[model samples]
Target: MTDVVVPATGYVIISASPDFSCPDSRRYYRDKGIMQGKTVIYGDIISAEERRAMKKGFAGKLANLVWRRDKTLFAPDESCAAVFVDLDDPRFANPEFLVSLATAGEQVRVIGKSDRNDIQDTIKVSKLGVAEVLTSEQCLTRLHDLLNEVEEIATASEHRDTRYTIDALIGSSPQIKEIRKTIRLLAEVDFPSALILGETGSGKSLVSRILHNTGLRGKHNLVEVNCSAIPDELFESELFGHVKGAFTDAKNEKTGLFEFAQEGTLFLDEVGNLSPSAQAKLLKVLEDKKLRKVGSVEEKDISVRVVAATNVDLHEAIRAGQFREDLYFRLNLLTIEIPPLRQRPEDIRDLIEYYLNQFAVLYNKGTIRFSENAIEDMTAYAWPGNIRELCNVVERAVLLTHRDEITAKDIRSALKRGRITAAERRQLTIELPPQGVSLEDVQAQVIKRVLDMFNWNKTEAARYLQISRPRLRRIIQAAGLEQNRRRP
Candidate 1:
């Protein structure tokens, strides 16, 4: 007899085995009589209430599940559940094909007729990611251990919700309001793919999480991969897992990011930085809905939502032949562009208030506030690093300011680091020969030129050189430009 149990306060039993008299399956019997005031008829009379409870208890979370059945060609969609299959059934002829194909969070265990099953068949199926190839004789001892593992992982994942929601994208500006609305709408449907465009540090990662955590598949894993960080040589192996002995160093079988994110969202950050070959491989998988491991011939069907984020302009990248045009179109289906913090200056105060409160609570600084003039000064500055820069400035002020109220002077002091104009940066540029020159020599000459240009007024020279006063002093002392300082 095959049986499955999904537990709520109690357990909901589902028995799929054809023969209840089969003595081998009797090992699963926990008791002879009723359990939790319900008759245990070996998968008979599973009450509607128990089923409802089972479904409700684990809503948006991984449920403790077990399914044992005769071998068949079917894939289960139980995210992170476990299944047992009888490999002695006629379906065992093609052992590779009989290995269970599981969704994002599921494992398959196969029970063969004997302990010494065909070595070749075992090797082939194991490489296909079968959780275990065991004999029916082994089930009595191993089932308990496998179930324990599933329960532990499920319990551990209970705390995995993204702390961000649509509200976490805090701002009252029209742009902010619209973005929130867009995220909420996106959360209601299962879109195949989406593209997030924005400047660096403009909260693309936050938006991606909000998109995943609030969406239909939020309960499943949200696997994130940084496209720019993965080496081109290992892109395929990293994203689509390889079997054991696939490569010299591939010591064990591996599961790729896509498999980990099965039936969930895969956030590919900095997607525009993918190499041309990697882009082609990604596009093929996206179109075919299947991926073959780097060294394996078998292809696994994939069901993952792809959400890609990038600061690079893909249109320019396509024109420059740096990115795939087809891949761009695939990802651009549903797009959200985050406006840079400078363009949405109205949101600056709201951000300041939010971050200030967060930092205050974190550092146990009670009831500190930014002065009106301080907020005004910050609202007027062009934040080159966007919201990320604003966060740093707020954290710095909170840590450095001594009083309860931060004044305009404190804000100014925190923001005093040099701001270089494009033209000024151009002015500091110099040509280097094929044989690279010393970096220190170049820096020394640039500092000397800026000092002489500003007539050695340290404040003006510091501003012109785009560095702090203390840093400028250090450069002066190190480069021996102290003597050239204009005398008071």
Candidate 2:
């Protein structure tokens, strides 16, 4: 007999035989050896026919019944033991035993074995203890309980996937590196209610996720709610939950974001967009860690780490009286201010390379690289929309790159179609002055401006001037342009 660890003290023999159709039995077989384990519901059911078969060897002996390793059912020196269960047993109706086993594989132990006999091998069950029989109605009542539990476990797991993966945080810039280090340091503390202030597309939501996934409650819930996305009428119901019939359309009771994020993290994206009333309600929740469901008298005391993000300036909003000052202070516990992409201009190249590689493999394209001019143009314009804009640019370039290298023409074409507004365009003019700045100085400025304008193109700038690479190099050296116009 194979050894099976007991999860709970019930149902020792789970039906192993495919033929046995007992709904309660987990597996079915004869148990070998002495009663060496814990006291629980267990035994081998020896049917009357099998008992008759035990007396004399026959063509239809228990050996015929055994279906394991190729040995006769039992040795001549061994005697088989048997216990018989009724066709109907009450224990099958109770759910406490089955649910624990099915979910955690806890609260039960079961096994199976078979012995040789002469008359005929038949099915049986051994009852180890007395249990009240549950009616067929009872079993039917909770028939789907186990399946529901399994499904819920699966869905919850899916909803809460990826608490902390570094890939989710998008950059390798020095600023990003510093943020990473800060997160590592903060993971050691109990800092609560952090505010992630930044422009849109600056990856505030991503940073919130990083904090939740890497912090103390990594194994717990990390629920996200978009404040701006929730309708005004339903804001309370969405965040603090609502009782059935709380409003005209509130036909059924509903759980809210606070309940879902209890004892874990609540990422309120666009928290600054909350209306005046919502702001008040949210402030109350933050102060008291308690919320009363709409149309209900009862209140729930919650414990959650609040992480709020916003594209709007809360300080400005507060000055304009659009946001509450007290609430702003509450949310500003450990503020992380993410500058717009244009401000952290040094990071564009790395982001370009990262996103290009990501999209190239995703779109099943050959290896791709940005031409010098293409890189320059990207860096030149102020990315008002920041990394988010860069991402869109890179994605489009990867899809449209006919050649392996993404050239200036491709970028200009994409931009011409409105990747950027015409008003934002700044053309690089590399003319040497008549009595102007030294040729070297002019070359340096021209190259730097062109690099920033076209996003850093050696060839495009050279071509624009109708010059060759060697000649361009001499001019670059004479002008000391290399020190000023390199792309990191």
- List per-prediction Cα lDDT, in the order shown: 0.64, 0.56
Best by TM-score: 1
Model 2 misplaced regions, further than 4 Å:
1-164, 167-172, 418-488
Per-residue lDDT, model 1, residue 11, is 9
lDDT for model 2 comes to 0.56
Write the residue-wise lDDT of candidate 1 on 396-479 in tens digits. 788678899988778666655433334323333344779888988788878875664454678988987678999999988998
Candidate 2 on 1-488: residue-level lDDT in tens?
11111111111111111111222222322133111212221222333443343323122222312222221223323332221122232343123433332222212222222233211111122122211122232222122222222233234323433324555566667787788888888787767789998877788877877787667755445666667545566577767878898887566686776776666678888888889998998999899888999999998898889999987868799999999999998998898888777666678878888888877764567667898788886776566556767787787777667788988777766554444433333323345557766655665665665544454566876776678867777877776766665342
The candidate that achieves the highest lDDT relative to the unseen native structure: 1
TM-scores of all candidate predictions against the true structure: 0.56, 0.54
Clashing pairs in 1: 80-105
Please estimate how well model 1 matches the true structure, expressed as its whole-model Cα lDDT.
0.64
